[model samples]
Target: MSNAINVKRAAVASLMDQLRADVTEKKLTPQEELAILEKLKVYGRTVAGSDAIYSSEGIIFLAEVASRPDNPDSSREALRCLANALYLDRQTVQYFIDAGYVEKASEAYKSENVDDEFLLGRILFFSTTFSKDDKLLDKWVNEHHLVENNIAAIARHATAYATAASTASSQAVSMMQTMALQDTLKLLYTLTTKLPDVSTTLGPTIPHLLSLLSSIPLQSSPLQPPTHHVLDALSNIPPTTPDSQASYFPTSDPTLHVSKILKILDKAAIPATSATSSRSTTADDFDSRAASLLKLLIEIYPPSPDVVKQLIRDTLLPSEKERSLPLGSQNSATLPARLLRLASSPTTTNTRIILQTLLFVISDEDPVKFVKNVGYGHASGYLMMRGIPIPSEALEEIAAESGEEGGSGKRINPITGQYLDDELKAMEASNVKGLEGMTDEEKEQEAEKLFVLFERLNRTGVINVENPVRTAMQEGRFEEIKSDNEDSDDDDNEAGKGKGKAKA
Candidate 1:
């Protein structure tokens, strides 16, 4: 037993030495570091004195490691060390915080000399695991002027740490809880306003802010205005901008700010109406803010089909009066039409929502004719079902028109051999003997054949209906079939019961 104990102790010591060496020299791969971390876990649980020595050594090693040039491989190992140290010895972590090692790590963070992933992991460990000795943080902050000298740095570090923690293992929760809400919020507020300054810096901060917004505990009294302040700031930046717009909004690159803003909105709970009167006051302000951002998006980026669809859906099927709009008047039509034109243009890719919106409009009147003339295929069925009057006169006139003298004036139906009226008129004016010899019956037969062929061509494939009429018909028929089958089953059961009773 003594021999076995000695062997285990030696193994633990060996692992600790390796961990220390790796942390100091930055020589370990992330994989090797992870192996060492696993061994530390075992040593932490099974070996005597392992926790004490590891915690002390781990802190020193992390401080040393963080000071090195940025290397993802080495930093990953450093993060593993910080995580283990925080998990194993909270008291030791406080020692580091008290001894000003935390401030040193923070300085490395600001220098942009450390790997972000490692710095994030280290800060997270410090923030969450350091004992609640306010003196430690206060002393460090006062001595280093943390809030004054490095407010931006602190915010950047906190945001990056929070975001990275969120994506890390489940251990991140405890790490996040270590932060003071007031301090964190204040830092976040400062960072949020400086988003335009740090647009390029916003990528890492966004996830962190979103996470903070999600984790913030709602309170009833002394309304938290800072929460709203952060939200408003995020909502102000447009998702898309010209390539020359800003460094953050690189012309060739997609802006992440848009996604970050969307995420913030998704995660934030609307403040309760009864919680404060200010909540009600800000409702319009929130919409106005959102609209401003959206307007910038419209101006800078062509509206996506999904976005256009959403606008149409919201406008047409608004849950509140604020969402709906009258589409009849010209002014009322402006937003929808602009969207439709953008969606309908050949130059535009992905125009499904634009087609849907136009279909809704065409379901009423002359819009159907307009869509057909423009060669849009997705809106046809809706227009047809809504009994949109296709202007036959206009169609005939268009068919009769000739482009130029040298051009073939005759517009022959591709599906049928019938010439358009314009074509026939041109032929007649040219006094073509072949057309003059045709009898009225022949002309009538040709017209009927042309109508059948054109109609079939329009329905089956040739003319692209914006929304195919057959699709609507098929859906209606399927529903009808299902209902009829259910009714038939019911009728059969009733008849069977009646026969059984009569026989009895």
Candidate 2:
């Protein structure tokens, strides 16, 4: 097997050397170049072939062939080969950069030919994806002014495609145009994330991004390709000033941007779950990106109209039936219920925090209303995590109003935000499997479990609290007992070892 692989590699190396020599001597014809490029393109699709190309300076050869003005067909093929090579073997990226090929490629963005534009965009996208050097990105943004010169024009061209896409059937829009737009957005997102200040100088890119977001037809999945890239790029480029933020929306429809974001969020929330597996990472990405964009818009919108707030309330907050249901029992069919479920999830931390914060904002940032609206069961953890104090008067008012009629004559259970009868039924169901049958040892084990849980919570900065079991032990609340394994346990502890079970 090894001998066969070595022979194949040798043949590939000889071919790469021949291509490099022909390109260097300017002796390769257009037809010959096309045939060699087809082979190079195939070779670049694998790691070993890409490595051979890089070692033989095949990237430089491909770039030279692609830059030949008279051989447009060969140039396109060469660009494809280079793109494949750079993508498959990221080590070729720095080599391409050091060879001054990126600047040459950027100049081609001025060409009216659509194929050249898309191919060059793909190449540039790979450069951004693979290169970690911030100096190069900074030079491209500030010194070269790539954003003003190339990126903005690319956005305009893409915007035209997106606008055309919005009105026409999906098949009518050119796939090449869509791909070019996706690559351009990916390039814009990577650059802005590295140097966010460049977003401020991105002349017409912001509107163009928004246009694409609004125009891009969501497939069976809302988080696919250009839509995902557009949202990601927009979130990283937030408005620098309050006035600038407000300027994005019209006064007549102040909630325009918020409405658009919620539409996406609504779709995203429908499928999100705390039990998401690795296969569902795309759903998680949508939730996180959409939540981030929503948070940015909410933070920037002026407080006057209250229209955006009202719109959010109508869309994301609890429905009429949900307003009366216990938060723990709320159906996940509604957006607010799904968000409430996600807000308590440990895995989706960013989505959780943003959901809680957005909920608080729509509640007028009042502790009492926040608790009253979502119930103490749902609101307490977030309030404690954020260190937002619940006023004594507010708590007292909530307690006083807990069992009120509220026009429905249904007495509310303030802790879980359920009606009194509903809470009683749930309590009865839980007690059917009560802990009364447990032995003293089992009870002690449960207490130790609680102690470990509190210790872990305190350690993680989720909450600050003393272990009640530890405090009880210190207060001499328990009698001591000896264990047969005590000596071995002590030896293990001294050796910095422990079993699967945690010590209290």
Candidate 3:
């Protein structure tokens, strides 16, 4: 290890000496500088080597080299080394911050070359992540217009990549361009997450990002980096106005944008069920984010186009076949059923809340409509959790109100959200379990448990209703009984006395 360190130190020293000579003599070509930076880049991958680079003032050298516009290739390579160094050794970011790296890097961020923008954007992003200096971020956005440049970078690369992806057959070039776009997005995410107000300026990025979603195919793990990153970035910056948001979708095919996003949401949230299928917490988070973004698209102020709203409704709501089964049945085969399953899962809390909120928005946030759409079985939990009072009319089927059918003829099973015909069949099944075989004690225990649950729900003030147990007692429907523990203690005492008397 010592010998290796010695060798690395000597190599770093020689490279630094050559860099200094070339800066003064101007003899080494841009290719030579790149060669040197490539070597430095490898060395900086470890802490000891990073310390070697920092010790020899290689950061300042790299920063100065990256600042040179005439040597764009060499400058980009230099920036890559600096970015790697900052990432490998986080403490080195303070050194870069002190050297005004953000200021220097921000100037080169708008380069027409995609590679330059990618490397510099990453460097700036790293500074934001690792630097303790709070004002550094302020300087990046408030002073340097980092948000605007990133937006432009995203649009430019997205268009270029989309065009290339469509026309070019080379997967390598497409992958590189894809990576460049992803880095710009990551930087933008850091900026927006830190100062969410910056999202207001992010209006220009929406259309490009939406377009990229179609061009970029999601991997087997649907919520992988670029796709998920795009979803998340879009979520952070929905347009403030209906017209503005509407304009972001293609005028020729408005459903195109919404459809592309919805496809990803379904793919991620509703994984294919096979022997090989696996689910991860990360994917759940991604799907939740996608759901939230879809909600934003659906609930835009002043309303989206009727066609767009109808498209979302058609895509997300229960189909006729799905309506034959319970709204969130385990065997139900539909996107809405799958999403409802996710929303009610114990492990996927965020996904549950997001999907529920998405459905609620689709229902116009009316309690009655929400229940009618998803059935009282699924809607009750979300409504109670959100403290929204369940509407009395939502719990039972109503005769079709005048002119309400609008040509869509179906009678809803108010409890299951299924068609009334199927619900009747299910109710007629004799195999349905009930309390018939339970002992008296067991039935009492079950009743007590239900009473406790209602009491707790009432205490939360989530709903205003008398506890059923209290009402039952007041109505003389239940009789007071000794506590089970007290009865057990008395039995034990009698047994003990019987044993003592036998011994006497």
Task: Tell me how many clashing residue pairs each candidate has.
Answer: 8, 0, 1
Is candidate 1 or 2 superior in TM-score? 2
Question: After superposition, which runs of candidate 3 have C-alpha atoms over 4 Å from their true positions?
Answer: 21-32, 54-56, 129-138, 141-145, 165-173, 195-200, 217-222, 249-253, 271-302, 397-403, 406-415, 419-421, 427-430, 433-504
Structural similarity to truth (TM-score) of each candidate: 0.29, 0.74, 0.77
Candidate 3 lDDT over residue span 297-330, tens digit each: 5444225567877878887877656777888787
Model 1 agreement with the true structure over 19-78: per-residue lDDT tens digits: 677646978776786676566555555334454345555566554654456555555455
Per-residue CA lDDT of model 2 for 18-97, tens digit only, reads: 77787569787778867877876776677663456665376777788789899888789889878877776777888898
Which model scores highest in lDDT? 3
Q: Which ranges in model 1 have alpha carbons more than 4 Å from their true place?
A: 1-9, 17-58, 61-76, 111-114, 128-131, 142-504
What would you estimate as the lDDT of candidate 2? 0.65
Pairs that clash in candidate 1: 243-251, 377-465, 377-466, 378-466, 378-467, 379-466, 379-467, 400-422
lDDT of each: 0.42, 0.65, 0.70
Name the runs in model 2 displaced over 4 angstroms: 24-27, 129-132, 196-199, 242-247, 271-305, 328-332, 346-350, 364-366, 393-411, 419-504
The stretch of ten residues in a row with the least summed lDDT in candidate 2 is 494-503
Which ten residues in a row are the worst by lDDT in model 3?
495-504
Stronger candidate by lDDT (2 vs 3): 3
